[model samples]
Target: MNSRNDRTDLVDTWNGKVEEWPKVRFGDVCEIVARQVDPKLDQYAKLPHISGVNIESGTGRLLFLNTAAEDKVTSNKYLFYSGDVLYSKLRPYLRKALAVDFQGVCSADMYPLRVDRDYLDPEFTAWLLISDSFTKYADGESRRARMPKLNREQLFNWTAQIPPLSKQKTINSYIKWQFDKYIRSRMAAKAQLEAAETLPAAYLRSIFQGPEAESWLILPLGEAGEISSGITLGRRVSDRETRPVPYLRVANVKDGHLDLSDVNEIDATEAEIEKLRLKSGDLLLTEGGDADKLGRGTFWEGQIPDCIHQNHIFRIRFDPSRFCHRFVAAQIASPYGKAYFLAHAKQTTGIATINQKVLSAFPLMVPPVREQKRIALMLDARRTEAERVHSALADRLKAIERLPASILSRAFIGAR
Candidate 1:
């Protein structure tokens, strides 16, 4: 197994010695061993199925597994055995390929490659397919096709250096070794990000669920403010003056944040726009989507003047003297709000939605306006800190994602 430092040392050595390896065309050491069969047949129906989507791009790793029967695969597929390299011909730029150790049925879009073991190792062949040189060639050739597909002739015609068996095995081992480390680092960073994301919830719980909260007034959200649905789009406006105006959709509202980027436009009359016009300090929530996102919302700060919202979003305007909009929005995004919305949300076909009636009845904790502002300020500070950590971790994961290409390029093409 090679360490990160060992990879660099090996690459430097390879840069000087690589030309000694016998150069050969890809077809010289491998053949596409296709055995097309109907997936509906009983013999193949029970076998695990692999498709282009199931293979992760550039990693040569399978993302998931399901049987042909489970997917109800009705079309013809290629049968592949253990130790065969599976490569997707469609969308060669995606770099989807893998070396499997179990018998399975793959989509017709993939090639079941059987390499001559004496010349090429199966795992090495899979890795070679995604090397920078191969990807560059495949991407160019595939683009020449009508649908960006690498025809069989185009794939087999590409040439490459055939390293000795010992060197081929070493390259595969080194790649897998580095990939294992990268995966572990990625998982740790993701876990840290998840924890950072939950910081706001923790802050919310501390203030809203403390012993003092029991002494505060509890009233329905409608009692503290106005809750109204936005204007409906694509409606028949008979004789009504309509014009295209910027409008916020469910996608624009995120938990505790508003993504003003790419705000879409909708046709609405003056009266509709006036009635549904978003104002500064207005709290907006999505009607529904994923169960976890049932009540996701944030305070709109009038980022876009005259901007309205779609009917799928509920606009809540609280009396400034009685309540702080920021405080109320924070409470609604807390775990308490999430639990209530999920409990009362109308669930149908894996989708959950909360209507105006359900949203109006939401129980809100009322404390002194001054106290509410203080808690909201503290929560905002914590949220800012968490966002900083999340951003750094996200950037790190992206950099890790690009490591495989660099590693593979160095191994095969001696790229620095």
Candidate 2:
């Protein structure tokens, strides 16, 4: 269908009655302020600078403010007065818009719109820009092949339903009340999720710091297991005519568990597969990726027969007579292990890498075999409980995130 028809269908489906209020072009009710000033200039160096990065999505809250003096902002920025509405022109799909209570200099990628107070309220217009309907409109118009952006011409030409000033105030008040409730619920869910995430780390820390830990012998990982790098892919594939065999990458290893959901295949001979293949009790650790992922790993249970791992992952075959794989894996995935990895890892940009020498040198606290088993079992149970709580809180947070648009859809349709 045509663009006009598509827009009408969207409005009717979302708001039910398009003719309930007078329709006006966005520009008719709001004046785009393009006043430019160099933020680094002496006159404006101390003023707060807003950018697309500074505003949180959906919520009109400013995340943090940076002055040109502090941030060393060198570019010309758009000047916005108090009460103006700030709309992000870059990445319109983010739906970032806010009504400011203070004067600031914003990045040129943002449009500081001053609404005609006689016709439209700034708060109401800010809400509309963040609503799903306007977001959809902006997304449609900003459909460039690459780096999609909402241009001033298209944004100004967009039409919106304008209710009476008194009605606008009432609707905005109702939306604010509902949104405040949603924000509180979201914050609580997020806090619970954070707590759940840290529980395992805390538990592990307490165990290591306990009085019993003093009796434990400290040894290097090389003393506990045979640490070896995995198969180098291209050489093995070319060495002989080989068939595709399931193999593990760094992605397959996670903290305390494996995610074999997207395991891939490689070509290798029978001898190569046997040499590099994973066993039921092998501990798999990643060499590098993000700083947090350094040395993170889990035990392998022979989930797939003849499964071998890539070079980026280190395979540790523990001596069953001396060490328990589960206990070692848990200790390596603990906060203590994380701190060691972060300190010793070779960092480039944001990525961190641990070489074979570093992995072999890992300091392991070894207890008696029976005590090791017990500790592993206890940590497993704690991790399971924490994961359950985290998963539930994550689901609640997802629902909370959708609440704002749902409330706005109801409010604009006169359903609330």
Quick one: best lDDT, which candidate?
1
**Model 2 pairs whose backbones collide:** none
Candidate 1 residues lying further than 4 Å off, grouped into runs, are: 1-8, 39-48, 64-71, 228-252, 261-278, 286-290, 306-313, 350-356, 414-416
Please give, for residues 285-377, the per-residue lDDT of candidate 1 as tens digits: 999988988789999887898899988899999889889988899889888889999999999987999998899999999999999898888
Clashes of 2: 0
Pairs clashing within candidate 1: none
Q: Candidate 1: TM-score?
A: 0.85
* Per-model tally of clashing residue pairs: 0, 0
For model 1, what is the alpha-carbon lDDT of residue 234? 67
1-416 per-residue lDDT for model 2 (tens digits): 23545433443443545457788898888888889998878878888888888888876667899887788889888888998999998878787898988888988888999999998889988888887778888888888637779998898888877877876776677777777788899898898888888898899887876788888999988878898888786673554767788999888888778998999999888887889989999999998989978778988998998899998889999888789888888888877788989999999998899998888888899999999999989988988888888888889899899887887776676321
Best candidate, TM-score-wise?
A: 1
What does the lDDT come to for candidate 1?
Answer: 0.87
Cα lDDT of candidate 2 equals: 0.84
Q: What lDDT would each prediction earn against the true structure?
A: 0.87, 0.84
